[model samples]
Target: MVTTQRLPASLTPLDAALAAVLRDLAPVQPIELPPVDALRCIAAEMPALRAYPPHDVAVGDGWAMRANDLVGASSYAPLPLAGLPVWVEAGAAMPDGTDCVVDADAVDASGPLPQVLAEAVPGQGVRRAGSDIAAGRTVIAAGEPLLPRGLLLARAAGLDLVRVRRPRLRIVNISKGGLAVQLIADTARLAGAEVVRLKAGPDIVTIANSLDTGGCDLIITIGGTGVGHTDAAVNALARRGALIAHGIALQPGRTTAIGRIYTTPVIALPGAPDQAFAAWWAIALPVLDRLSGRRPRTTLALPLERKIASGVGIAEVVLLTRKQDHWAVLAIGDLSLDAIARAEALLIVPGGAEGFAAGTLVDAYMLRE
Candidate 1:
């Protein structure tokens, strides 16, 4: 079996360090998925074939008319028209040959006949076709996460379906915990990603066979990833391929391992439930987002009530709750599953001191609601 080398703790910030490591390593092999079903495809961006508001659609309930027809029309004395002007309700299509819309609010509609009280400008109240989005323009770029509004926009642009990069994933469960595996599988399912799991066994052939036969785009081996003699998951991965990173300068999940198996990424996590959650949130989640062509965004930091101390040289991820607009430490122990369970955010205090003073500014990332 090949032994693995431990990653050095550089003086860089955790985010920067993680980024540098990721930059040096290539992303895992990609998978193709249907646009309609590619909800969480990594790094996928589709262009708008047709512009938003593809045609001139009305923005309000009003009258559609040729600008010239209303040039001299006013409430003082109404100008007669050839009846080209028609009443169009809000969101109604502009009539053919009509170049403008006069909002009903702008004119007195209480009259038996709708009358215009003011002259309409050339482009007054007109929503020109392709104004919101031009044809053949890229509405969403690669590396942008699909938001709810964005999805709606894509559909509005006439994209019935889209091609998305699959959310390649690796789920490693260590120790004797069955709950961890179940949770990981459930999480992957919710994110629309495929997963692979492994139990604690010393058989290299079984491990290798799992890698060779699986449909996973990434690998996750849980439990045995720490300093224990049975913690050979990292070693096993290195023997199979090159090591990416073996240690992180972060607390609670500092022993996390990142490496490669062929072109697939293998991430090993600590067995503790809280540590596992931290590793997944701080590392795995961002990697998945980057690979799937989505923009990387962290949880927002809420206000803090007290000073918390972190390791002098280790980046700390603190579990906390935003109560009354203040971020209160949910639990001081990194291994506290209760803390994680109660947390709506994971606050990052970069590796440095043994702890944080109350009120120190720290970064925070919000969890999915």
Candidate 2:
């Protein structure tokens, strides 16, 4: 069903070339989802339904009344208790004639009437109508993440649903083992992509055809990109469409491949957990970000305390540990999950450079995935 082909490891393309190819892709159509289900999704656009605190409200426990009523009130000669002060608690609607709130601590509320010990400012202790969020203001802008706080904002604005840009994604692990697929699926979900898993039998041709036929925005496959006889992903992809990139210079994931069947992108990652995770960020995450209209992860330049060794012509990946005010180099080549869990960031030694020396500056990618 499939045949093996191999190329020397040095023949792989540069990492920048692969990244350029993935950047040209565009986002897919958006989907409507309730606020609860839209967590971490990319927002299409959010026009608020109603203003937060649509009416003027009391923001403190005390009486709500006109500020002018306490113009001469003072502690030395406090305003005597009136028949009664309009009592209102926090979040209660202020009475029609009230323009300010006298804080409970600023007045004596124990008695039937209230006594003011301080002058009341016009806006003190009062949450005016639409004060936090104005009416018709855009709450969620285009390409912003629908985080928990954003959901709360939506609820405050009287919105029960939101529109998010979520592309359909399909994952297929060429190997019989399923761990690689699980890792890929987790990463995809983190990027807010809707994942659909496809179970392919041992037939490589069947696997290839099924992957190419799916309408998903992206297709991800694990294993079968190496040099062994069983490594057949390249051939399978070649049977359908072009393999844009066969390999990348980055360590651990040198054999990662990218292909396209018409408009949908297909990514083939290594079977090893470390390699798979690294490639998922270095390669797949960027593609997903572009398609969903989300900004790429921020990169921080930090100083390394120890020398990190790497090749000049090959792209090298190094992990960094957080030290006091700076970072320590932990270039075990490519980091495993457990090692990365302990590390603070992933540093990159580009194909243009050899490596970084101790106390030198290195550009590192933050742990965003």
Candidate 3:
């Protein structure tokens, strides 16, 4: 059996740890899924089809005509064009001769029919086919996380299908039962990934040997990631491959370890409930996103209810929630499973975060989807 040593105790920010994990790890092959559909995933860098508006389209509900038609016409002396102005509403095809839109409001129907007080300028109120988007242009660039709005735009651009990166996560753990296991499985399900848990002894050889039959893309060990003698997951991972990072410079889940075994990403978390949860949330999630060619970003924010003390050297992720307009913490301990179970979001007290005041602006991640 091989033995591997850990890095310094300096706690790195969550992003940095993930970046280190992603370093040298090969990106997944892009796959052609289907027509440009689906909202959750991102589009492949170079899409399979060209985007549009190949030409300009209409923008408002009005008649399209040349600007010179209504040059001198006014509310009183409205211009009565010799040719009939084709009636069109918002988003209708412009008339063959119409180059601009004379809005319905800008015209009067006092005499025989609709008469415009003044003529419209060329290109006024007209949406050029390709004005909003151009055909043959890169609608969604590579490495950009596809948002709902972006997906809609891509569909509108006339793309029938897209190539996207499939981000698959593989989980290995000992606890296949209990609330912790249920919660872990639930988290993976919510993230739309597959999870695999293993019940191996804490011995490094036992854990390493079990992982040898590798079928997973990424491996996460639930128990035995701490400093205890029996905490051998990290050593096992290193024995199988190489250590990437160990013991980030932070709290509760500081013993968290990340490495690569046989070219697959491996992460080690504390055995305690809350610490393990925090480790997965803060470290594993971002690494997964990066490996999937996505930049990790979160929006769940919670204000600080009360002051919390933190170490000066390491970053801290304090769990917080909204309690009657004031933020209240369930507890500060890493083992405080109750608080983690009930948290609305994670309060990211960065490295060097001292104790915050009662009203400090703390940012947190949402626990629920």
Candidate 1 overall lDDT versus native: 0.64
Q: Point out where model 3 deviates above 4 Å.
A: 1-23, 35-38, 42-44, 47-51, 60-62, 103-121, 134-137, 176-215, 223-250, 254-259, 270-273, 296-308, 311-316, 320-331, 335-369
Residue runs of model 1 more than 4 Å from their true location after superposition: 1-23, 28-35, 45-50, 59-63, 67-93, 100-126, 134-137, 160-163, 172-175, 185-205, 213-216, 226-250, 293-295, 299-303, 323-326
What does candidate 3 score on TM? 0.65
Q: What is the TM-score of each predicted model, taking all chains together? A: 0.71, 0.88, 0.65
- Best first by TM-score, ranked: 2, 1, 3
Model 2 TM-score, all chains together: 0.88
The local distance difference test score of model 3 is: 0.67
Pick the winner on lDDT between candidates 2 and 3: 2
Estimate candidate 2's alpha-carbon lDDT, on a 0 to 1 scale. 0.77
State the lDDT of candidate 2 residue by residue for 246-283, as single tens digits.
Answer: 87887768888888888788888887877887778777
Per-model lDDT:
0.64, 0.77, 0.67
